[model samples]
Target: MTIQAAFTLIINTLGPLQGNREAANIAHIVIEHITGMGRMDRVIYKDKLLSPAQEEQLQQALNALLKHEPVQYVTGKAWFYGLEFTVNRNVLIPRPETEELVEWIVKDTHTPVKILDIGTGSGAIPIALKKDLPAATVWSVDVSAGALEVASQNATQLNLNVHFEQIDILDTTATHSLPLFDIIVSNPPYICESEQKDMEEQVIAYEPRIALFVPDNDALLFYRQIGLLAKEKLVPGGLLYFEINEAFGKEVVALLEKQGFKNVILKQDLYTKDRMVRGEN
Candidate 1:
């Protein structure tokens, strides 16, 4: 079948599940993954047709999408901070708001400094930060080995030198011996368990649960834990950054302030949701 024909079939099938805009976007991404052709290339080859093998692959991706699997997972890659990173069911797909957090970190790099990214799935935070601020020493930690594997692979593919370690942030006694940092950042799981029922089925069902949830009553768990760690592991005046849940921006800022972090600031995303927070120890 022609590429155009296959694209129409897939888009028509999945389009209604999410929306026309998302379906069209996913269709383009799937075609690019299977044929390695961008929008222009797809247009150029519209009449050229997809081979049988390519058609089969496209059908499989469509099935996954119809089941509410994220297009990023369907394509095995997602773009963050304008860079591509590998993603799977094990890691949370990097989002645009996280890019703002990376921007916040890079902007503060007036000099070479030690940096740490907590819950660094896909190593997106550290990799993007390092790509822009090459002089900084960057390290990332995650409790899941599978997540760390994806993060490490992303670092290698991007040729960004970042140290990935498998360690839980809540296990403070062990992390206490780790080296100090000039900037500690995280896009930690701030979603409360009760919120899961309200999330899109694709997200709640397909994305890694451990990477997306905290106790229903303790939504600020990671922020509080990481905030304390920043106090202990960061130099005096060190910076702390977080990609927080929009609903808890005020609470997160308060958590940092209660821990004595100064200059606590909450920044919004392109949509004007309070999504990023920064403070100094």
Candidate 2:
């Protein structure tokens, strides 16, 4: 089938499930991924026929998408902070708000400094930070061995030296061996179990649940642990950053303050939702 024909089929088939705008966006992403042709190139080859192999690949991807699998996982790649990284069901897909948090750290950082990232899913946080701030020594830790594997592969592919370790941050004793850091950053699992219903079906069905949720009654679990640990791991004047749930921005800020963090700031993302927070040790 011609590229144009296949593209329309994808849009029409998915339009009923996903909204028209989102279906079209997914169509564009899948088309580019399969054909390796950017927007202008795809337009130039609109009438180009997809080879048999390409057709089969398209069908497989469509089936997965019909099941609400994320397009990034479907393509095995996701872009963050201008770099493409491998992704799978083992890790959560990177999002734009996290990029803003990274930018916040990079803006405050200069010279060689020790940095640690908690919950290193896809290693996107540390990898992007390392790419931008080459002088910083970055280390990342996650509880899931599968997640660490994916993060390590990304760091290697990006040709960035980031130390990856397996540690459950929830276990305070497991972090004792970690060295002190000038900056500690985390985009921990802040969504309450009750909030899962509000999230997209693709996210709930295909994304790693361990990386996305916390018990509803203990929604601040990661933030509180990471904050307390940051107090121990961060050098004096070191900064701790988090991407928080909008519903509990004030609560997170209060939690950091209670942890003895000074100059705590609760910042909002582009959408003006309270999404990012930072505190000084």
Candidate 3:
């Protein structure tokens, strides 16, 4: 099949399921990943025929897309903070809001300081921070071995020298072993179980639940635990940053304040919804 034929097949197959714009996006992502054809190349070589192996790959990708898997997961790649990352079912795909959270850290932080990332789902946060703040030392921890494996590979591939370890942030004993840090950031599990009904089908079905959902009753579980940990592990003026659920902006600010963190601020993302919160120890 020609390149245009393949594109049409994918777009037509997914249009009804995901809508026209999204279907076009998925087609572009899968085609570029498999054939390495950029937008111009796709247009320039619209008549170029796909080789047998390429056709097979496209077929497989189309099958997955039909199931409503995210294009990032289907491609095994995602872009975050201008860096490309390897993603899988084991790791959550990095989101634009999370990138905003990272940018906030880049702006507020100036000195080279030790940083700890509570959940290392694709190593996107720490790796991007390390790239922007090249002098800073970064360590990231996660409870899932599979997620750590993916994160470690990303760190090695990017040559960023990030420390990836399997540490459950929920475990006080394990967390105590971590050294003090000047900045601690997390995009931890903030989606409440009760909110699952409202989330996208692809996210609910394909993304790792352990990295996304919190018990409805204890929606601030990670913020509370990580905040307390920060109190113990952060330096006198160290900062704690979190990508939070918009619904709990005031609640998170309050939790940080009650934990004795000062200068607590709830910031919104590009959409102007409360998406990030910062506190100083």
lDDT of every predicted structure (CA atoms)? 0.89, 0.94, 0.94
Cα lDDT of model 3 by residue, 55-110, tens digit? 99999998888787898998899999999999999999998989999899999988
Question: Against the true structure, whose lDDT is highest?
Answer: 2
After superposition on all CA atoms, what RMSD does each candidate show versus the true structure? 1.1, 1.0, 0.8
Error of 3 at 105 (Å): 0.5
Candidate 1 lDDT tens digits, 1-281 = 88898788887898777778887888888888999888998898898878889988988998888888898998999999989999999899988888888887787789999999999888899999999999889999999999999999999999999988888889977697679999999888888888877889989888898989989878888998888899999999999988989999899998899999999999999999999999998
Which wins on lDDT, candidate 1 or candidate 3? Answer: 3
Any runs in candidate 3 off by more than 4 Å, and if so which?
none
- lDDT (Cα, tens digit) per residue for candidate 2, span 1-281: 99999899999999999888999999999999999999999999999999999999999999999988899999999999999999999999999999999999999987789999999999999999999999999999999999999999999898999999999999988999999999999999988999877788989988899999999889999998999899999999999999999999999999999989999999999999999999999
Candidate 3: minimum summed lDDT over ten consecutive residues — where? 62-71
Q: Clashes in each model (backbone N, CA, C under 3 Å)?
A: 0, 0, 0
Alpha-carbon error at 182 in model 3, in Å?
Answer: 0.3
Q: Better model by lDDT, 2 or 3? A: 2
In order of appearance, the predictions have TM-scores of: 0.97, 0.98, 0.98
Work out candidate 2's RMSD over C-alphas. Answer: 1.0
